[model samples]
Target: MTLTEKTAYLKGLMEGLNTDDKVIAAIADILSDMAAEIAEIKDDVDELSEVVDVIDEDLGEVEKDIYEIDDDDDHCCCCDDDDDEDYDDYDDDEDEYEEIFDDEDLYEVTCPTCGDTICLNAAMIEDGSINCPNCNELLEFDLDDIEDEDESESEE
Candidate 1:
């Protein structure tokens, strides 16, 4: 049974006893007061629960607006485009990127001080040395030694 109903039942039982004891009368009054307070608290809790549900719905709408969430599909607004022409344009951009960078030779160099790897082209290496981007330490390259090693390897 509900707390209020249980309290009411107790009050009825106390009244039926017809006791002359002051303690029993006081206890019954206390139970009645407790029942009233519990009812008010239950009402307040229900109202707050409804307010929370409304706030949750509002927050959902705000999130949809901020993130461009579509209800129709799982994809974001940008990826929802059905046009093949837009996809073709993206492919053209990728081809242009490949054409520009495919011909150049890229070398990976590791910094001794910071242990960070950096990519460099031939023109950058021709400068003989570059400051390590991570540690600002001067890193020198001896192209003459590398050429001699290459020559020896060819002779072998």
Candidate 2:
């Protein structure tokens, strides 16, 4: 069942109790748990909506013709590309960028520190380091940072 429906069901259960105060408090506690699950589901949906999939190969069709904010970058998943190309993979002379990484979504990130633009799928950023071709500057977080972030999030 959908998270919203489940939350509503829990709310109804909490509302229907004509029993002792203890039972009512127990139902309230369960409702809180259900509400937290619903919030997580909402977050999952919001994150998934940011995913840019050009083709649903399983469905044999492309529903949303994915386009980029600029012509110079396409969020391609392949990370084995030459490190020295300096955005030959892009369309034209483009300078600015930001990380559009979703966990399963492809992201095209430009390194402000080294002036190197990178096309990272979920896999490359999973490690989180795209070294610059010229100065070899390590731009953005490495895998360690990613793990740290996960740990902090779990603690929350």
Candidate 3:
């Protein structure tokens, strides 16, 4: 039974016994006070829960607005033009690209979208792409090009 029901049952039992002891009556009074306090606490908890839900909803709206602003701001192609120049420089020095595998034999890749660092083995990279853990963005990598370069270097 609920706490209130249980308290009522206890009160009934105490009264039914017809106890003349002062302690028994005092115990009944204490149980009634406890039951009242419990009810008030429950109400307070419900109000707090409602407030939390409102805050969560507001946070979701804020995130949506931020993403919308980002989308609108993406129309400026100046950032992409800078990235193109960087890529061209990287392509010109292809021979300078060393193996990214660290001591644990895992390739450390930075997600292009979220910039989160991720570690993956050869097979995982060979799958062509993986989702970024931080932003769930699809991060593509070229395993075929790396393998081809390695094969040519070994033959030389």
Clashes of each: 0, 1, 0
lDDT tens readout by residue for model 3, 1-156: 877787788888988999788897888788888888999999999999999999999998899788654544554656654635646778756644344443436779998777899988877877888999899999888767878999999999
Q: Per-residue lDDT of 32-140 in model 1, one digit per residue for the tens?
A: 7988898999999999999999999999999999987878776545773774565888999999877756889989999999999998878789899999999999999
**Candidate that beats the other on TM-score, 2 or 3, i.e. the better one:** 3
Error of 2 at 64 (Å): 44
* TM value for model 3: 0.42
Rank the models by TM-score, top first: 1, 3, 2
**Against the true structure, whose TM-score is highest?**
1
lDDT scores in order: 0.87, 0.63, 0.80
Q: Candidate 1: worst 10 consecutive residues by lDDT?
A: 75-84
lDDT (Cα, 0-100) at 5 in candidate 2: 68
> TM-scores of all models?
0.44, 0.24, 0.42
Model 2's alpha-carbon lDDT is: 0.63
Q: How many backbone overlaps does candidate 2 show?
A: 1
Query: Can you give the lDDT of residue 29 in candidate 2?
Result: 73
Model 1 Cα RMSD, 1 decimal: 7.6
